[model samples]
Target: MAGKGVFEEIIDGDVYKYYADGEWKKSASGKSVPIINPTTRKTQYKVQACTQEEVNKVMEAAKAAQKSWARTPLWKRAELLHKAAAILKDHRASIAECLVKEIAKPAKDAVTEVVRSGDLVSYTAEEGVRILGEGKFLVSDSFPGNERTKYCLSSKIPLGVVLAIPPFNYPVNLAVSKIAPALIAGNSLVLKPPTQGAVSALHMIYCFHLAGFPKGLISCVTGKGSEIGDFLTMHPGVNCISFTGGDTGIAISKKAGMIPLQMELGGKDACIVLEDADLDLTAANIVKGGFSYSGQRCTAVKVVLVMESVADALVDKVKAKVAKLTVGSPEEDCDITPVVTESSANFIEGLVMDAKEKGATFCQEYRREGNLIWPLLLDHVRPDMRIAWEEPFGPVLPVMRINSVEEGIHHCNASNFGLQGCVFTRDINKALMISDAMETGTVQINSAPARGPDHFPFQGLKDSGIGSQGITNSINMMTKIKSTVINLPSPSYTMG
Candidate 1:
């Protein structure tokens, strides 16, 4: 697995790494899968895949090690995470290229994902140390004559284990948002990254190992999601499941049954451009949000709702912007890159075709090559259109026109997906009204909707997501409250 010229930089400790319980081991099934780069469709490397039985063994190891891991002082745990962050920074270049190769990310966006992930890990690590909890007495002898102090004060405490299922588009950032906090809060994790991005993710797992965490405390099992996903979700030992994707997140919710389930499903996010908004800025953000990461982000804007007063001008300008976008290999810094999988592109194109047949106007041809779905613009769309309500998760935007801001807000709320929505307007009253009225987890005004810093709570309303994620909320979500109380004796006993 190492010592080759191309892989010379990877150390023995970093390469051929395995799930550990203080020692490295092979998959019980002796089954392994070749990790592929979906962009170029090349096999990058191979990793061990756990059978259902092997999953149980890893879960057992996690359960056995949880208490010991939890007992370690909080500061030391924090320090280890900080070390992991340093290691990620040290390995950022190799990791970035790996992500671009696996997922076909433009070099710049690839760097963004890798670096942002390291920031998340480092942020969670520092936060874990500086924060803790204590119980307080409500009333005591220090209180006035007749009353006794007896309440409690506390902070977030870790759950035993969190199993994370990350998506193919964002191999590192999304998973780190879950894994970093779960670890910082002192919980063990078992990760199942998409088969395509497994190599970059495994390299990251090794970084955690190098950071000084003992084996099996933080582990991975890579294979088909169908093979081991059900086991991880339903396992008695998995106290929590953190998932990121579309229908898969919903499926996990079903299998989770009684376990605590946290999901970031999908969103039909919209960018509403009012007549009074700046044409240049609105057009810029529209293309940036809809096409960045090739439009694969859960937060990526999918629908553009424009007012008739400005629809024609806006459409012309936006089409001009879209036309300027270069669609080709990610290695060439193309404006739009290939979709993660061929099936995914096919799925999105079907939706676009449906919209076109239903009377939506097309501003450009929907291009497809191998697995890549090039940018496509659909205008004159109606809220009743399926493309308007469902997450395309591709480079297709269904543009609709409404009479007023109220109507725009109505259209935004019409979808079952409601992760995040953004409005472009200088009208403070209208902006305030939309931000307050829009039924979504986050509302952005004059900017594209996006996943921000690790400290802010990341979640959604309605079908978009359940529970929440972000540094603070994630710490709270991965932890449960346990009140500790102590009863004190009154100085004057009536019986005496």
Candidate 2:
């Protein structure tokens, strides 16, 4: 069992080397990137930032590991994944603490991320067997003459070395989500976690090492995306790239050339409230989806579209609920915490101020203390407003009034992003109608648009992203389908 002390050591700042070939090593260039604790706005540690040359070395190691990993028995790989999950379970508390210290994640949310990540590991281990590419018989049914003459075989083939890049918002969960499936699909992984959330990820790498994976099977490269992002993604060794970030995912996809790219990008998710919505329930759900984690999640509710008949009432409930949310240090168990960086805080503030200057009314007073911003609800916000379209990624919810459900759907669809959205109503028919019409990937009838179980298809439509992320989907994404056809001698029938 991994001890609490093991997890604590991850945050102590002494272990700053990048993990490669089952060992930690400093960058050959001897350069490092400073990691800041979001809660205090202070530099907590510096991690080795692998240079392009170091990336080349890591890719070579990963490529060599990929061949054997792909040949390993499925059950054997699954067993190791389950073992990693057990290690994570033992150090759950310590892992959550690291997240709080590293990214200023609210304690409860941080723990949930860690536990869910472990769940993802377990879920992938089990589901990988079921989803593993199996030989499928292909028959020539349409051509009766060739019925028994042709048959096709299909199998899921591993895509060699995978370069997985995770976002800052979900350092552990999303990072592990990528690693578990990549490994289960028999692909070696080279993970690049952003500096904002490197500690939790490095700790996760530690857990992976404890799981007894072979050397060169997994590596962690920490650094600024600009410095080594292209160097890693465009390398010839990487067969596929699984990325979750905003504009960076797009940039990588273009440079990745013909390689398979699975990306889950940004979102401007909205929550629509019809005239018949239950105000109390809707308000609570809205606050949870919008403000939790300081609105850092890709699926967080960035805008609210409500019917004019019930807009004012819902806004009141939202204001009351937002007012009660405590904004403090991550350790304080606040309902809200600091954004990842000062620039993020400033961006949110600037959006709110821009909305106000354009006549958007604030429902409650907002407080900006350094990197943290208390919840702010804006009323009378127009769809044309930047807040309505941009991904603020802060604790700000913009409420826009709509005349009808059609108008609401139209407004939601007009945005460049189509990640996730939800509609609140009791009418089953109406719910189905809105859900089908909405352009986002997933729609919630009476709930917020958030990623749920590890088995469900968690993906974004349109500009939100190109590929999906779930146990089954990720396995398919990480593996390639190969079909083989063998022509057999045609059977001859003798007349008796």
Candidate 3:
């Protein structure tokens, strides 16, 4: 497969280079990191492990390019973004294959991610043209005392350079979610793609290169975060940050100091089921939301809070659905694939053991082969068990029985992470009430917690994240409003 020259545009031999100043350059550090295939447990490719000095060079290039990129007309920027989107769509298959090999993402979903990223870029381009500024005329007669005339105009301006950090899951889609918005808003960007997902992201960056964005406007740095993370975030060259990850985001926020930050962090999304809910529909969503992508998603249903009256029935339906999921390699497009790494698999195993020791009942026999953990459904998951409150980030779904709507709301609100939550019921009034009380960024009345079919307002409350992210919100976050005021000379009154 390596000899086929599939990723030849972005990769040289077996190693991918870091992108800076419109060129793919080898690292001066003389070091590289292996990208392992989870299914085969083999190193499929390598990416540069750059030095802090290399990061400083990228920062300088981005800082130098910011004003020029921001000065470019908004229409031209949007046009280039559209072209990049087209390039991404044209190369979807190869990029998706890279995702499958790099991160164990199922083939079908990886294709969807690439296509969705293209659509997101296209949408951001369209929205960029519609970001309206404001003009207002003020009169002192509105106040009681003086006669004066004032006129004000306000417009959004780019916040210089934006540092984007995307997680391994949804690599293409999430990376574009940051890049396109930052570009459309007239800001230069420096992307730090996750180590496991860097190859696919670099391919995406290559699309932007084909689109003819100004040299140095978009750069990608690949390496261990511990080596260059602080230097990137703390550097004055970065004007704003848009990050999607876990605890790393918190650490970045502290080190990033006063620079603007838009983060989409960890989630412990809850699924609350009312007694009046449709058992069949509830069960289907639970399985799909909890186990899809092997439950690596931040918005994946982490816990199910069902009314005690209907807990037993819901568990039976959910278990039946889980039994039907196919488990195998991503090459075959199975429903559950091996997780990204062995340590992640070990962490999940620890959670399972903790639940078992504390009396949580597993519906199926526990099974694990290396990083491939079969789907697990735990019942009677008491609050005392770690599985009830902790996010497993694996194919483990815990069912916690609650007696009433109030009890469910209380438990959901008490959680530290609040990215999203869902409630299933036929009662519209009850659904509306729960939606209002839930402390999450989004509430699904009868559906599973998801990021989007459209880029609506997605965010988190407590530790989940900071700021809002959607098409417009993200653009707004990366730019700031600058207002110009003019005090008009007192008008000479002509007798009329």
Candidate 2 TM-score versus the reference: 0.96
Choose 2 or 3, whichever is better by lDDT. 3
lDDT, residue 461, model 2? 82
Deviation from native of the Cα of residue 264 in model 1, angstroms: 0.6
Residue-wise lDDT of candidate 3 within 353-472, one digit each (tens)? 999999998999889998899999999898888887888889999999999899899989999999999999999999999999999999998999999864799999999999999888
Best of the two (1, 2) by TM-score: 2
Best by TM-score: 3
For each candidate, the alpha-carbon lDDT, in order, equals 0.78, 0.86, 0.89
What's model 2's lDDT at 123? 92
Model 2 global lDDT (CA atoms, 0 to 1): 0.86
Sort by lDDT, best first.
3, 2, 1
TM-score of every candidate relative to the true structure: 0.92, 0.96, 0.97
Per-residue lDDT of candidate 2, residues 1-496 (tens digit) = 1223665433324547788888877777766788788878888768877788888888999999989999999999999999999898777787787788888998888888888999999999999987883558776644765655667788898999988888888988889888999999999999999888887788788888899999999999988778887888888998988898898777777788888878889898889898888999899999999998889999999899999999888888888888799989999899888898999898889898889889999888878989989888999998668898999999998999989888999988998899899989989899989989989989987888788787889888877888888888999999988888877688433369
Off by over 4 Å in 1: 1-18, 22-25, 34-36, 42-45, 133-137, 140-146, 149-153, 491-496
